[model samples]
Target: MIPNAIAVDSATGAPIVLAQAEHGAESHGAEHMASTPGEHGGAFPPFDSSTYASQLIWLAITFGALYFIVAKIALPRLANIVEGRAERIESDLAEAKRLRAESKAAEDAFLKAQADARAKASAIATEAREAVARQSDENRRRLDTEMAAKLAAAETQIAATKQAAMGNVRGIAADAAAAIVERLSGATPATAEIEQAVDATLAR
Candidate 1:
């Protein structure tokens, strides 16, 4: 606030004294704000414009140290890990290829064995069939020969029996005729004459 230029009493002496006192109070407040900056708001030491060059120099040193550690140490370890993984993958692929080839060869061998077994079985079956056929034919021929011999023997026996029966019938007929002649004429006929008559009748 501005001090009153005119006093209440309208005297010049009181007005001059008031103005001097106000001036002195304002000068004292200005001195107190300049000496103790912390008492009010002010710039920190690091952010102060007078210390800018020193802050920049320290920032450059820290950045250089971090860059060197990443480039020389961390990067080499990461490269070795990548190369190890790549070599392992290549070896695994080669082993898998070799196993596949062996599996194919085994399958081929199994198929060939099956084919050979089938051919051998077929040949054995054919040979068995031919042998059976030959045995059957031999049996049939033997039976036929046995039946022919039996039939011929039976026919010869029948012919001999028939001849003997005929001879008996002729003799009986001759005796019956001789007896009939004796009964009619009251005298016996001669045996030779009776035999001749019987023979002539039997011939007709």
Candidate 2:
């Protein structure tokens, strides 16, 4: 800015005024060139040096918000849901185990009851068969006793009938012989002698 003169205050010979004015003009020109570069000269917005601090600040805010949401709202809720599901699954598994144990007990009881029933039935059947056998034996013994008594009575009655028939036949024969002797020889036989003769002939 100073061309060919050494400028100074006329009285005190100070050099402050023109130097300050030249320095201010130079700083203004540099500021203008820095603010308005030519086309295709400065970097893209994202890579620009002037905006790096603002971009980093906004990035930090976004990351902090995401972290806060995950820590405070999203993660706690998800953890609660997962824990509830796990607890429910554990309770359900315990219930299932209990049910399985109960089922086993019930099945054992049922089997025992079935065995008892079968044993009872077998005992009943055995008793029934024994009773039937006893009844059949008693009936057979009773029939045999009746048949023996009837046979003895019938034999006794046939012997009595034969004795009476023989007595009647001997009398009739003695009478017939006496009649025949009277008609043929004019004589009657003695009763004692005729009886003795009939007995001897029957014996032979």
Candidate 3:
């Protein structure tokens, strides 16, 4: 609110009075028609040269106070918030990297374990195959030995049978010759002579 009287002179330090009638001339009943003398743009009183120093002083004070609030209060709080967010982001990134490394290590370990298991299984399978082959070969050799023994025994039995049959054949031949001689000559041949003769023929 501006008073009808203005205090503080421009240079002489004397009080300046603005009469109510003088103020009314610049208005029509209740509406403003113009601003105070030396002021431009109605309702904007800062353009008045009479109050230029005061306006500048207030402007400087307000600007300084705003600057102080921004520098000392708002800026520090904002900086702290920004720094805290930055640290949190960095921490999250580090944690993510750690987790990724752990996951990669675990994957590598699993792969190694799988490969080892496969190798062990292959070794076991190879050993089993070799064992089976060795067993089969041993069985074949044992069977061959048993068969050879059986073959030898059978051969001995055949030879013995053949010798027995041959012995009976010689006796039959002697008996047949004795009977034939008796029939033809009407006399029986001596058994001793027949046996001797058959023995001689067989020896030849």
Candidate 4:
């Protein structure tokens, strides 16, 4: 069982045992804190005045090293890269201009060549037409000459045939006359006399 009663000290009329224990605990906590003041100080060493100059020197050294690397090495590398890129771009532009000029020249040359070829073809065609026309005219002239010669030969043949037919008619008329005189007069006419008489009658 636990006693729930008030405690009293007979000597000083107070609770001496609990008061002494609380006082001893408070003093012990204060002694522990005073003994470890250096541990707490170490957590924030930069706030300590004893090492302030050394921190400033280290900070300056680190900043100088970073500045040297950036200025001397990294910045030069970046500048070279930018310059090379610019040169490449300029070279590409020059090449493009040259190609464009060449293309234009080629197009002009092709057009000229096409015009020349067309002109040559037209000239050849014109010459061929002229040659064909000349040949046709020559053929017509030759045919006309041959026709004139043929017509003249036919007229000459007709005249010769008419002269031979007239010569036969004269001989037949003389024979017919001699035969009629012999029947009517009982005397035959002389051959020479008959021929002479027929010739004279034809002349009259």
Top candidate when judged by TM-score against the true structure: 3
Best by lDDT: 3
Candidate 4, residues 1-204, lDDT tens digits: the string is: 112122123334245444434543664445334432223323464675534666789989998999999999999999899988999999999999999999999999999999999999999999999999989988988998898888888878877786676568668877887888888887999988888888888879
The better candidate by lDDT, 2 or 4, is 2
After superposition on all C-alphas, the RMSD of every candidate to the true structure, in Å, is 17.8, 15.9, 12.1, 18.5
**Clash pairs detected, candidate 2:** none
Compared with the true structure, what per-residue lDDT tens digits does model 3 show for residues 1-204? Answer: 123222222333232224423444554423323434222223355554545665789999999999999999999999999999999999999999999999999999999999999999999999999999999999999999999999999999999998898788779989988998888997999999988888889889
For model 3, the superposed segments whose C-alpha errors exceed 4 Å read 1-46, 130-204
Flag regions of model 4 displaced more than 4 Å: 1-52, 119-204
Candidate 1, 134-157: lDDT as tens digits: 999899989988988898888888
List, residue by residue over 1-204, the lDDT tens digit for candidate 2.
122122223333334434434443664445334432222123354665544666789989999999999999999999999999999999999999999999999999999999999999999999999999999999999999999999899998998998899889888877877777778888777888877877787778
Q: What 10-residue stretch in candidate 1 is worst by lDDT? A: 1-10
Residue 69 CA error for candidate 4 (Å)? 2.9
- The residue pairs in collision within model 1 are none
Candidate 4 clashing pairs, residues 3+ apart or interchain: none
Single out the weakest 10-residue window by summed lDDT for candidate 4. Answer: 1-10
lDDT of 1 at 60: 79
> How well does candidate 3 match the true structure in TM-score terms?
0.43
* Model 4: lDDT of residue 27: 49
